[model samples]
Target chain A: PDEGAMAQARELQGRLTKPAGSLGRLEELSIRLAGLARTCPPPPVDPAAVAVFAGDHGVHAQGVTPWPREVTAQMVHNFVTGGAVVNAFARQVGASVTVVDVGVAVELPPSPHLLDRKVREGTRDMTVETAMTRDEAIRAIEVGIEVADRLLDAGAHTLITGDMGIANTTPSAALIAAFTGADPGVVTGLGTGIDSETHHRKVEVIRAALALHRPSPQDPIGVLACVGGLEHAAITGFILRAAARRHPVILDGVIACSAALVAAAIAPESVTAMVAGHLSVEPGAAAALAHLDLSPLLDLGLRLGEGTGAVLALPIVASAVRALHEVATFDTAGVTDA
Target chain B: PDEGAMAQARELQGRLTKPAGSLGRLEELSIRLAGLARTCPPPPVDPAAVAVFAGDHGVHAQGVTPWPREVTAQMVHNFVTGGAVVNAFARQVGASVTVVDVGVAVELPPSPHLLDRKVREGTRDMTVETAMTRDEAIRAIEVGIEVADRLLDAGAHTLITGDMGIANTTPSAALIAAFTGADPGVVTGLGTGIDSETHHRKVEVIRAALALHRPSPQDPIGVLACVGGLEHAAITGFILRAAARRHPVILDGVIACSAALVAAAIAPESVTAMVAGHLSVEPGAAAALAHLDLSPLLDLGLRLGEGTGAVLALPIVASAVRALHEVATFDTAGVTDA
Candidate 1:
């Protein structure tokens, strides 16, 4: 991010016809976007790209959620055919959707807009063994970086995260607790609206896994490999690459929030280019966002994690930038200043 | 609102691919919109129309704000020329803007997209006398209803409220206090970034006006005539007409919210057809919204009040409806349901 551009944006906002600081968070958002674009009144955040990373979580075997693991592949097909929630929202915002198969348990048939970048079958049951090998986590992350490059090269000004992995919230809770040093019970939530009994079991599973691995937040990749899902690792790399390239990435729900914890841990400076799209009903999403010092744009109690929240917020992010680009200055409008 | 359509929408939402209650407020918003549209899935809120009613405030003579009263007429020109914040946001959401000269002090020139619907040359200073005669207030509201009819007849599926009036927040605070039984100090705020002295003076002005008029909330028209701007009276009529016709109307900042208070008082059932677009930084806006029991969709600290906040929220409103219309059902997508 360019400090010079941010300073210029702040100066520009003061000159806008509206009162100083009346736009509130939107004025700050525009300044941040200006810094990211390296110019005052940053370019429009159009032609946004959504990468829905699909995987299977071995924790499903532990009954963390009622949804079956095979549903992961089913959702991948749903996303590819444009029948999923993410697809509907993407269409609404004119953003293209791509499905990244980081690690699905079953073999997936190839299709357009589906990138087959499976690292392995699926992460191991974390309560019994490590989620994945360190090398496998790195490979999955590389897949995300490559996807970010592809999306940016194809003319996407903004990158949005989406995920479809049943029982993935188990790993997300574990990762958030690990990075933020919060209690497992505090970070875990009822993923997909689980019963109270299953929710307790889910929290217990996360606590046990964290106790077993004791993954240090200082080593983000090690923490990811030990307890994080392939999609989480991939999203971490996606965030890192977006920040490295000075483009904005809108994070979706708890899944993306946990992944952002890993991305921030690996590259602290990358946090500048990240935007919390919405506060999910999942408690871990809020915990991660609070830890990152980012305030979400929307709070609709959304817990579905297919980038639906991020896509819904695309218009808001664009509007913030558009304000800087299009609003007339007080002098130009010949209006009396307050 | 049609309870049958609302019930049908709730049932339809349960069948969506995502888990029940996962989309959260959006699910409820869609159901509410369905009831307003009287259908399972409401018609898209496209070709939305924004009516920016411009007026001058007699309260400006009370020295409530630093901005000159003439800025209201100047802003009317800025809105017509598409240089205001509301115009920028309207363009982003594909909503049309129409400036209505309901009570500008100066004789305005003819222009395209500008409606010459002046009821009077602004209102009388409420601290000294009634803001207007009761008959004049009723005429202003009639103007609002006529504008609503013209916009709806021209194919606008959604109506957005906008206002351009200097020192309008002084009257807004009085209206909110009169209707909600709130303290003047609690409802009054610094409009357009007034200094501490001006803010204190503004609150005193509201308190003095409320004391002088002692307006009755039961008689909404009389209250408007005593302590409301022409834009406020007109917006009340606009909201009433939209509710009478079973169409949704998005209310903007403090002025619109104050008008909504009068509208809801006149026709309590009209609350069913209203949507609070954004929570304005203006204290009166939130007080009025709370009294109306409408939760704002966006809260970006926007106090621009040219329907900017409402225009920015158009996407969220549209997306809520689109989710119900487009998202695949669990059975259709062949995914395991929770």
Candidate 2:
């Protein structure tokens, strides 16, 4: 029945008063809406929520990004204070933003916008030990599900997944390599503009971590524990919850993409709600996207790790949904055949 | 004085959040805003007006597009009835759409959204004679100026250029070849999905038109009269008026890009207010963007000519402007620099 609903939505989109298949991803969004709502003209859905998961990685000790771990909490402060780029974009698009401290080391002040769901103060040093235990991974995923349910009950029709973690890309690259069977050298890049020599060192660090853990793909949570940041696990859980609720979810950059890969492994249907916002310049991002068979809308070679790319892309998603709902059909307009 | 303002805007964008040179065309938009408003931070620009210029070409008898000329009127009706994709996108983004009958064969009924500004029923066959007279060209330009002024008075801070003329790509090819000094074979392509054989025929038609009228780039208006649609002339005039009034203008597709070339010829500063929405799939569009030194943001291989791309891109432009106005600097956030 859901498949039939999805097909009807796709047909209705094809019949919209424009060129057939012109809106691209927007067309898919409309079709998804049809299946979700089981109605030709779906009810108006808005009041979106963007959850930005923040964490820290012990890999920072290896000197990958120029910035330190302290900046994660500071940026989280900026996010909560409504001073970040994502905050501005959310305001412009009428979406609310919540910052979740999934694994930051510093303490956060109580605020309505801050969701204190930390799994650990910080991940274990992946270069020496697993980032976290498998049980911790489950806890992080539960954190994501709780966040999604809270936002869903708050009347958010769409969920946009965002993440903020320093040195998170190392774990992302590790997770991507394990999932896609790609070499760490091919999947990893300098996380935050490291020097050439530092980049070489970063690669060696990942190889060593992989050698120590020897994580298997059969257990995605084990792999996440070995290298994945807390935010990634939370995002994976959030995506699963969103898919269970049948709400559209927009994935941000590499960290979120890594989390999504793990989420999809847990529940394959979870990929149905995913929208790749843009192809991040991060090498892991492309690998994650390729593994998932998803295409990003924008490609400006952006490597900024915040939810900036996703925030910039929110309006385009809104346009796609709007196009599906609003454009008149050929029969209604009495136009000739395509 | 305008140049000074443009310089200031560029400088301000340079200091905004994110990398110095990142955001690509969005950075250019900020600079354009600076020049248009003659201020550092451009006015809170919104309430955009998209003028969808509708016209018919006598060259449609040459069989350029698959659709017939009657479709132009029907599409115009769709625009007025809010059934078009551009209409949906505009409504989503809170912009008003006005369809102008620059030169359609059929008379349009009186409608509040339809602008009865037809210079003639249709243009003369450019293969045989000039498409429009110099007097008609001037009147069309004046029509554009009047539309921009009225839109500005109506609290539209941004002016978006759109077109809906059937078989207009023939003239666009001719204009691009004449102005860019490129051979018609290089600038022309099969518009609206013509077969390979029909595409060859369309190229031959363009080559013949160029052979018939040797247009001078120095006299853009004369070149416009020699092979321009009423919609093209009006868009040129509209861009000029928008620039003069310091209203930001977003160029739609190839036709609008061709008109912008003429507008820039008349007033080079007019480029300051121009935002290239996408590098259209049309050969002329890429050539025109290169000639104008403008980089478009969205490039999804779109050739739909109803300003749908531009309307869809408005949210991004709004985000750039909002980012400039909202995002706090490193100093404000008191965060450590990368």
Candidate 3:
């Protein structure tokens, strides 16, 4: 039944007014819609929701970023207060942002936009112990799935997955290394602008975590428990829920891309609904993108996390979909074939 | 006087919430607003207008693109009929598109969105005669300026400059080479998907045009007359008018960028209000961007012209300006210093 929908979606995109194959991934999106909705010209996408998963990493104790872990909680405050770059972008795009406190050590005050989905105060120090337990990982994933369901029920046709975590790149790097089978030294990069010496140290931190975890890709939940941050696990679950619901999800930057790799491992078909917003300058981001066989729509050497990349990319996606839905074909325009 | 406005614009952007340097080009845009409006927090950008200058090149007879000359009129019809990609994007973004017939060999029917401002039916073949007369070039430019004034009076705070001309790359390459001092071989590229052999032929076509015109950048008007297409001259005028009116202008791809280079030569301060949407994979585009000291906000290897890149980028610009106007300051959010 899903295959039939996918086929019908592809046919509908082919019949859109533009030249064959002109709308690019948007054509893929329209086709994906057919499979998901079991209808042609899937109902207009409206009321998009953005889930920004916030967490902190034990690797902060290892001094990966110059910024303190407390800044993570403060930025979460900024997000709730609409002061962060992502808040501005989300507001401009007319998407409501729900910041998930999956694993911040500091407690967040209750607010409409803040979702207290914390599985733990913070992940266990991966340098010494597993970052999370299997149960915690599952709970985080469930949190993500629940958020996706709520957004879907609230009439969000698109769900943009974003993450906010200080020193989170350490876990993300560890996850990328395990999934892509890349060495830690090859996949890890300077997070938040570490010097060459610090960058090397960051890599060692990732390598140490990898050695301690020895995560197997076949055991996705085990992998998250071993090395993934709470935000990573949550994003993975969110992606799955979005896929299962047939809603398109835009992945932002390296951390989100790493989480997406985990989601894909959980459900390969989920990869179909994903659109990479931009290729981050981070080596791990490139590795993750290559592993997923997904090409980013923009490359501006942007390393700023938050959902800024995804928000910047939203208009382009809308353009592609609009092209697929609106441009007249050669026959309709009475233009001769090339 | 313009310098004062620009300084004000910069100050306004600097005051917007989020880190001072976080939003990058968006911060630059907020500053651009001060300069354009000559006031802080430039009034909300509304009634945006995209003027698409359409022309025809005598060089089209030389067989450049797989597309024939008639396709220019046919596509213009598509634009008028709202069947073009730009139409869909503009509609989705809530901007008006004005199709200006600067130089098309065929007569166009009157339409609400169509602006008939032909300098001539078409340009003289640059490989033989100068493409346009100096007087005709001025007239076309005047047409662009008048369009800008009309749009501004109609309450547009932003102007998007687009162009549509067949075999326009011939003139664009020549102009880029003359202005940027780039080698013809390096700056010339296969436009509109011409095969290698035809690509080489197009290069020869540009070289012959350059040899015949021997254009100089010092005399910007003379350069426009020598090899600039009608649409190119018109865009130059449009950009200047936007700057003079303190309105932000979004530049499309290679052809528009090439015209911007000429406009910059005429009035260097004009560049203060211009934002490059994307770098066209067109060889001349990078050189043009470098000469203008402008970095493109997006690069997806898009070579499709017709203001499509600019229209796609509009939302990002809007987001940036909105960020300047909306995002809270560190003090307001009580977030820690970076």
lDDT leader: 1
Docking model 2 quality class: medium
DockQ of prediction 1: 0.79
Q: What is the C-alpha RMSD of each candidate to the true structure, in Å?
A: 1.1, 2.4, 3.2
Chain A TM-scores of each predicted structure, in the order given, are 0.98, 0.95, 0.92
B-chain TM-score, candidate 1: 0.98
Root-mean-square deviation of Cα positions for candidate 1 versus the true structure, in angstroms: 1.1
Model 1 per-residue lDDT tens digits across residues B1-338? 78999999999989988889988888889999999889989998787899999899888999998888888988888898888888888887889998999999889989977999999998999999999899999999999999999999999999999998998989899999999999999998877888899888988888898889889999999999999999999999999999998889999999999999999999999998898999999988989999989999988888888898998888888888888888888888888776
- Candidate 2, B1-338: lDDT as tens digits: 36887787677655554445545555667667776787767776577889888888877777767877888898999999988988888887788998888888899898988989888987888888888888988888998998898889988988899888888888888888888888888888667667788788888877777678887999998889988888898899999998888778888888988899999888887887788887777889999889888888787667777887888777778877787788777777876767
Sort every candidate by DockQ, greatest first.
Answer: 1, 2, 3
> What lDDT tens digits, residue by residue, belong to model 3 across residues B1-338?
35686676566555543334545566666666666666666766655788888999888777666777777788788888888878888886778988889898899888887888888998988888888989999999998899989888988888988888778888898899989988888888877667889888888888888888788899999998998899999999999999887788999989999999999999998988888988887889999999999888877666667887787777777876676667666567665654
Worst 10 residues of 3 chain A by lDDT: A16-25
lDDT of 1 by residue, A1-338 (tens): 78999999999999988878888888999999999879988889887999999888888889999888888998999999998888888887789999999999999998976999999988999999899999999999999999999999999999999998999999999999999999999999998999999999999999999889999998999999999999999999999999998899999999999999999999988899998899999999999999999999988878999999999899889888888889888899988786
Clashes of each: 0, 0, 10
lDDT of 3 at B245: 77
Q: Which stretches of candidate 3 lie over 4 Å from their true place?
A: A1-45, A194-201, B1-47
Off by over 4 Å in 1: none
